[model samples]
Target: MEKYIDIIKNSYSGYWRYLKHEIISVNHWDNYFYGLIIISVLVWVLEIIFPWRKDQAIFRKDFWLDTFYMFFNFFLLNLIILIALSNTVAAFFNDILAKIGLSISSFQLFDVDDLPKVLGLFVFFIVSDFVQWNTHRLLHRVPFLWNFHKVHHSVKEMGFAAHLRYHWMEPVVYKSLLYIPIAIIGGFDAQDVAIVHFFNITIGHLNHANLGWDYGILKYVFNNPKMHIWHHAKALPKHVRYGVNFGLTLSIWDYIFKTDYIPHSGKDITLGFEGDENFPKQFLAQELYPLNLNDKKK
Candidate 1:
């Protein structure tokens, strides 16, 4: 009977350990979802306190769009790529990126002896910022791409959903272009990549939100909701006004580059591409458009 007891105990121990590991892994992936839930709740609370827009639909139309985008970026993109591409075409590109000396693998560029989570986090954000900040600015300067990029600017209601009403091109550019440096260099771990996405996904929405949240120096330090809303502004000259708020998480580079703008009156601003007020805002139109600033229809 003692031997029988040991066998049962062993079976229970094996089953319990398997369950524990499963829980940890699930929490790791699902933590991103939890972060969104938590942030969204906080944002709702903030909307009541410091409202930014006058449009009623701001509340109605934008929440789901933002949620969809949050879902797409955190899970869909990661899952599809990891399953279909990351180890195949993706790995090839990563190696090529390493050869070119752009970004490094988390396993290689980082010192194995000792590494700081803070520094890794900082590098991840900065590198991604450098890529995105420039790409976003280009969409404004380049006439051809503005057609698709303008879909993001077409939003007038300014709500959480407004945050997600981007042209598919935006995500294409964001994931494909921005992640290039990260993928090629191979310098990040799964956790490092996860944190960067968390901040990018969260902060990007917050900056574009209709609800007001006082980030203050954080506004100056990093791109805030106000700063981003200004980027989408449709007003004249179509310059990158609040473009100074380029850094996704840190504005040191923006300040260094002298591109940061913080408006004085503290009012909600208009956003749209300068020339094409008639451009379509629908998904299909945005996918096919670029409002070529170079050649007018005449």
Candidate 2:
């Protein structure tokens, strides 16, 4: 009982420290709130002016729930889970590497600062997107993983907030996988990572937004709303595979892998899983939805 009490106390203190150090000290909360406001206003305006589905309401079905998901993920889930997972992965890897007479501290592939900013940015973007692409594919292809991933796909209505409607465990899984590889490559410093992250967030929002725009020939390089909307299609065309268009920012991966599934028109497409009518519609329910062990039996 005393040990358990101590553990709880220590965990609370640690979290408080993290909240102070990582969030407050760095002004992450201010930046995130302001950035979200700016993007939200911009997307809201764009949606009103150039909606893909003219009949789609501004405050469509599940909009509030998705908004909750966005806040939950950005403020609580990501902060707690990502930091914990990052530390755990670092410690675990360090211990294993030490046993083998290797050290991440000594690992350096290139000096990122020495490279031109554009070149460094390009390399980070490509590598990170590749990692995310594979991870997204795995989430859809692996049945057990899809149970959690389905939370994101449960959104029947697409919007900017839909981009953030991911399961809480996803960032931990994706970021931990990304850390080791990026660490080894060594050229990407904090600024380079931040730049890639900014582009990723921007593109991710646009890809899910209801704005009716496909970059035409440039869609081959960058993912567009039209291309990504097909990914959420309730039932894909017969020719396309079960899970297609797993790219995050770049469509080049899908092109290379032959998983690109954009047709001449997406007019008839419907979003979300076919049998997801019973999926939870509230934030708390959705958070707990992934933990229901009975899902494995189905």
Full-model lDDT for every candidate? 0.58, 0.77
Writing each residue's lDDT as its tens digit, candidate 2 over 28-81 gives 533554556567768878888889888889987778877878777876774555
TM-score of each: 0.69, 0.87
Question: What is the C-alpha lDDT profile of model 1 across 1-298, one tens digit per residue?
Answer: 4544454555455544544564455556535556666776676656656676655443555356555655654445444332233334445565677888853454354442254777767766677778877777676666556555566666765665455565555656566675556654445576666777767666766776665554776665666776666556556333554243555555556677877665653355655655555765344455456544433341
> C-alpha displacement of 260 in model 2, angstroms?
0.3
lDDT (Cα, 0-100) at 181 in candidate 2: 64
Which number leads on TM-score?
2
Tell me how far the alpha carbon of residue 65 in candidate 1 is from the true structure, in angstroms, after superposition: 4.8
Task: Give candidate 2 regions above 4 Å deviation.
Answer: 1-30, 105-108, 237-241
Candidate 2 TM-score over all chains jointly:
0.87
CA error at residue 135 for candidate 2, angstroms: 0.7
